[model samples]
Target: AQTVTQSQPEMSVQEAETVTLSCTYDTSESDYYLFWYKQPPSRQMILVIRQEAYKQQNATENRFSVNFQKAAKSFSLKISDSQLGDAAMYFCAYRDTYSGGGADGLTFGKGTHLIIQP
Candidate 1:
């Protein structure tokens, strides 16, 4: 079985500052994808960033970035220049390339609630 874990239940950052959210997962397979998704009040899951297992360089997008440590199985997210709109429940997810059985979709963590302070 595979499982994603977010150590922080809630996090806060001042506007224009930076924040890092911690995440870790357990998987026996080598080929997989890791992702970070943000869900605001509207309840839409938006993909922040994604990383392929074979990639050594981390993936980055605008103010969002990830530290993918394959050896330790840790994937952490860093949000720079935090904004009010960035406040949301962020979830870490994992997906394997080959699903021998059926596939539901992505396996997500409990989520870390992000609060941006003015």
Candidate 2:
């Protein structure tokens, strides 16, 4: 079973600053996928970024980037030039490649609540 762990329960950052959210996972398989989803007060799950296990270079999207340490089983999200809109609950998720699309669902971490101070 693949599991994700988020050590931080909550975090706060000043507007226009930066923040980093920590996430770690345990998995036996090598080929898989990792994702970070953002849920705002509206309660919509938005795909923030994704990283393929086979890729050595971490994924970056605009102000968002990941520090993927495969050997350490750690994948962290770095939000630069943060804004008030960035305030939300961030969830780390994992998908197994060999699940055959059966009863397997995205395994998600407890989530980190990010609060932005304007």
Candidate 3:
């Protein structure tokens, strides 16, 4: 069984600054996938970024990027130039490649509540 862990239960960052959320996972399978999702107050699960185990390069999007350490099973999300809209609950998720498929629900961490300071 694979599990995702988010050490920090809550995080705060100043607007226009940057914050990095830490995430770690345990998995026996060499080929898997990691994802970071954002759930705002609206309660919608949005895909922030995803990384494939087989890919050596980390995944990045706009102001969001991942620091993936395959050997250590660590995948962190870095948000640059954060904005007030960025405030939300960030969840780290894991999916086994060999598992069912796309229809299978993702295994998610508790989540990190991001607070934005004015």
116, model 1: CA deviation in Å? 0.3
Instruction: State the lDDT of candidate 3 residue by residue for 16-111, as single tens digits.
Output: 999999999999999988999999989999999999999999999999999999999999999999999999999999988865655456899999
lDDT of 2 by residue, 1-118 (tens): 8899999999999999999999999999998899999999899999999999999999999999999999999999999999988999999999877666564579999999999999
Clashing residue pairs found in predicted model 3? none
- Give the worst 10-residue stretch by lDDT in candidate 2: 96-105
**Any runs in candidate 2 off by more than 4 Å, and if so which?**
98-104
For each candidate, what is the lDDT? 0.96, 0.95, 0.95
Stretches of candidate 1 above 4 Å error? Answer: 99-104
Candidate 3 TM-score over all chains jointly: 0.95
lDDT of 1 by residue, 12-113 (tens): 999999999999999999989999999999999999999999999999999999999999999999999999999999999999886677754899999999
Ranking by lDDT: 1, 2, 3
